[model samples]
Target: MQNYIFEIQLKVRDYECDIQGIVNNAVYQNYLEHARHEYLHSKNISFKQLTADGIVLMVSRIEMDFKRSLTSGDTFAVKLRIERQGAKLIFFEDIFNVSDGALYLKAKVDVIAKINDKLSRGEIFDTLNL
Candidate 1:
């Protein structure tokens, strides 16, 4: 079974939908990114501080599978879990409808940290003991 370490709830905005009245594909990425930022904030990890310290964390790759469509006003939850994979940290994220528990999307985001402009194993994981 998948264990989610964090979750955030959000609603679909009218402007996020396309002519078909379903959320645009690209907007799902925004939801995932926002949830990640919020998760980091909850852990007291500040992106601004990381930048100032010359440590930059970036998404190296993203793989997403769309399972269902979300329309305007639909409420959903973004759930996340992180694991260290060799030199990278992989974030496993899932989006599900809050009303009916229907999964909408699943994504794996591969991230790597660069220290002083050089790619290196992220030390943040050690700091957070994640």
Candidate 2:
């Protein structure tokens, strides 16, 4: 298990599943994204304010490993930790089944900060103490 700084629990919805009766590949991205946004909110950072300040957080890369399938009505938690890696913020995120503690997915997301449409060194993140 990784050292996680934040976690958010979510339940799988029926519509999120495909004909295979498991969550579609694309739906997992939404779960990860929502957890990130919630983490920012917990730190008192507003995405709207960031945009007003000309600071844009963009996804440079994302790697997801599907270890197990999430079926409808399944409960899970998205756990994540962030670290500074030069000009980017690397998020190590994982999903696990809440009921059985089974690992469902592992993801690494690379986020780059842009100020005034130019790539930044992510100093803003440091000041935020995130």
Candidate 3:
């Protein structure tokens, strides 16, 4: 409900809908991921560079609560806010219908980093200034 640090608008595609004429439950994950990547990119973080540096960001967990169904052609926005919880970055992302300001989903994504294939204390995140 607070102002988000990052936001991306997207539209529901026909192929993303299920037989019930609503977006498939699993498809929301992809939307969330795309927003996160775009946010990081905007901050000058590149996954390719991280991999070349032997640093890897990984999703440890995700929780999503569907509040309303999204039908094909629905325009929505995915907004993100984040906090550092020790070695993990806890992301609070919410999806809202842009047309009516209706909340479509609420999600919490937990992300952790590994340096050289081993989990680290997330020092890299501190350097990120996120």
lDDT of 3 by residue, 1-130 (tens): 4869999999999999999999999999999999999998999999889889999999999999999999999999999999999999989999999999999999999999999999989788899888
Model 2, residue pairs in steric clash: none
- Per-model clash counts, in order, read 0, 0, 0
TM-score of each model, paired residue for residue: 0.96, 0.97, 0.97
Global lDDT scores for all candidate models? 0.93, 0.95, 0.95
Model 1 TM-score, all chains together:
0.96
The candidate 3 region of ten consecutive residues with least summed lDDT is 121-130
Better of 1 and 2 by TM-score: 2
Q: With candidate 1 superimposed using the best TM-score fit, by how many Å does residue 106's alpha carbon deviate from the native? A: 0.6
Collision count of model 1: 0
- Give candidate 2 misplaced runs (Cα > 4 Å): none
Clashing pairs in 1: none
In model 2, what is the error at residue 59, expressed in angstroms? 0.6
